[model samples]
Target chain A: MAQEHTVKSYDEELNQLRSMISRMGGLAEAQLTGAIEALTERNAEKAQRIIAADRSLDILEQEIESQAIQMIALRSPMADDLREIVAAIKISSTLERIADYAKNVAKRSIVLNQSEHVKPAVLIPQMVELTKVMLKDALDAYIDRDAQKTIMVWESDKGVDELYNSLFRELLTYMMENPRLITPCTHILFIAKNIERIGDHVTNLAEIVYYQVKGETLDMNRPKSDDTSFAVVPPPANT
Target chain B: MAQEHTVKSYDEELNQLRSMISRMGGLAEAQLTGAIEALTERNAEKAQRIIAADRSLDILEQEIESQAIQMIALRSPMADDLREIVAAIKISSTLERIADYAKNVAKRSIVLNQSEHVKPAVLIPQMVELTKVMLKDALDAYIDRDAQKTIMVWESDKGVDELYNSLFRELLTYMMENPRLITPCTHILFIAKNIERIGDHVTNLAEIVYYQVKGETLDMNRPKSDDTSFAVVPPPANT
Candidate 1:
């Protein structure tokens, strides 16, 4: 899939950049999964691992930025090549945020894990899994230059939001029913929100990919169904 | 302050891009201010106006992207010129996100306005104003090539986080004390969160400006003090 570049080193430099993005994407996925598993299993040690690992993402982000800037400076790439470098930088930033969200989720595990070992929030695992898939697909599409795959990844964010809303209501119900539950449930609420934001960052990747490959913006608005518009009131007592 | 460019049109193009950024900044400021007003005053119409005005920010974002791409394509800009274009793209994107956060805050106005009136969440206006200043200073720093100004903006995000945490605890205390306050307070909580996110985006602007002006990354981690890291157990009832 190598294009006939007059200078082959240009292609090699871009490949190196892509590999960095790929590494960063993989680390974000691992951090997310580790955080979710820690939550579900009440494994504080695992959560700590996720937190400890976030530093690598930070390093990778810095590397990506340097590589991208160097590429632009050395090659003076135009059009699609310029867009690709820009997309790499944007993707790394989003991945760094995703890793931060993972770290947030992991930090909550120490508290939620110590508390009466209740089950993890039901929908969070599902939400995290969806984001993992979306993140993977978004990165894959970028590497393959596949616009259709990127859009599919983009469309999945709505599902994550719907799942998040359900989790929000369910957590609120728990908090209201048992005042003691408030502490743990609030942590779960934020962990879920952090995962939801990761989905958003993943969708951002999709947008960057689509633009990088197709040289056109995604004309459709992002699908968002956050339950914020719904009243946060618990159901009436009789119900 | 025009540098001697071999091509006069390059400076003109950069200036035009700067003007678009300035206009976009103005619109974002208006949206943030209008959203804050609607939340504080319970004016659904004003909230709706802010929501409607978000389209202009979106339009400006698209325009910036197109112009940046076109400039890069036609000029094959190198070194600092390339970085400036990339930075502009990044800043516009962050501005778009800030506007979306404003829209989210405005969206909450309907419910908060409809519910029985309550005093403003004590720190939200303060947070919004701080973000507005950070955002304004960040952009001004970019225009003036003022690394010092951008760093100042970067440092201010910690204060915004402190304000957000305070608003969070106050809202939660009110909701727990009176279930009737849960509904509006929940909306206020989100509005506060939205404003907090606007602050983060403003910090993003600061990062881009610092990089663009100094040709170096800000050598510090983002300041963060989110309460989620703290134990969720309500503070011992006796202060």
Candidate 2:
């Protein structure tokens, strides 16, 4: 009866950790969306909100890390239990980084707001929307422990990279045409880079989820891994 | 006698892990240096060498990861020992990413070699050297378990960022003045960004070393954590 009670307590703690991470992930996804909205819409107030809310994510990350440590100390968890706790810790860190990148994007929006507009870039918003979707899907995958959804998030990152590269070229052309625009365009460049980085972080979380579900490493950069059986057809090559 | 044997075996395993990581770090540092040299000197063969050698770093990373897992399974280490093994795994991943950035730099170097010279940029080479030194010092700090060296490496990262930002502005001017130079200049921009990323990774490794030694999180992005005693002096404001 005592052992059963201990197992029950462990499950409760694990569930609490998962819920906390899920809440944190939700907030991070919202932050990413708000950041993109702030930039694309030039809403300084929304950007400020995104930046201000970063403190909460930091606190949650630290709290979850401490809780994981305490649970490990108390339970000496093994196998799947141990993997889940470690995954929670890693996923929390990755989510916090995504929030940080979102905050960076918001900060850049503040800088870009000071200048007259460059031609509104279509790809930036598209990239932001895709990344936000990936962040949301990755969190959902985590909450449901669905490896397939996680894999979908991983596959979507290539699209983000293509968008970033195209944006880079577009910005390069703008800077070449008008040197005076460099300051504001540079800020915009960083905004795009931060969004791209958030996509990478979401991909990192997906890889962690893959590990939690499969007890194996998934190299998102490489095509061939143990999970190759689930590989989706490559998206039409981006030029 | 059994206790003594166990202690010796534990020490041996820890030392081997340390040795493997140090060698991996050394190889990664070399790869970064070679990649930068290839770009600045326009040596395609050197770039090819860096690209070819990256596979070894990937293999080393996997070996270290598996060894760490085996250690955890066989010994069930606790406290600092457990943290050290976990740190090794995380650091190996960071190092591998740094190697990937180096490969990217090398690939860009090959592309840049095909184009006409964009006025020879000197700052990027200096930035790469600083980052390489930081990686070496950070790894030394890890192996020696020296918090002081880790702190130094962390502080040095601010200088690298300053250099990177300055180079970004300068390159922007070059591309603007000579619009025809955009292709090669963009390649150089990526090279600079990759080196800067390598610096960031080294700083991350330093922070991990600080955590392993101090058992506390140090905010790398922020100048100070809640505790002011360890607050790093902010880099002089970039103009």
Best prediction by DockQ: 1
User: lDDT by residue for model 2 over A95-213, one digit each (tens)?
Assistant: 98899988878877776777758873567899888988898888888888899999998988888877877677677567556555555655666677777778888888989998998
Candidate 2: regions farther than 4 A off: A1-8, A69-76, A216-239, B1-8, B69-76, B216-239
lDDT of 2 by residue, B114-184 (tens): 77777646888898889888998998889888998998998888888878777776776665565566557
Q: Please list the residue runs of candidate 1 whose C-alpha ends up more than 4 Å from where it truly belongs after superposition.
A: A1-8, A78-80, A116-120, B1-8, B73-79, B118-120, B220-222, B235-239
Candidate 1, residue B89: how far the Cα is off, in Å: 2.5
Question: What RMSD does model 2 have?
Answer: 7.4
Which TM-score does chain B of candidate 1 obtain? Answer: 0.92
Candidate 1: the clashing residue pairs are none
True contacts kept of each: 0.20, 0.07
Error of 2 at B214 (Å): 3.6
Q: Lowest-lDDT window of 10 residues in candidate 2 chain B?
A: B224-233
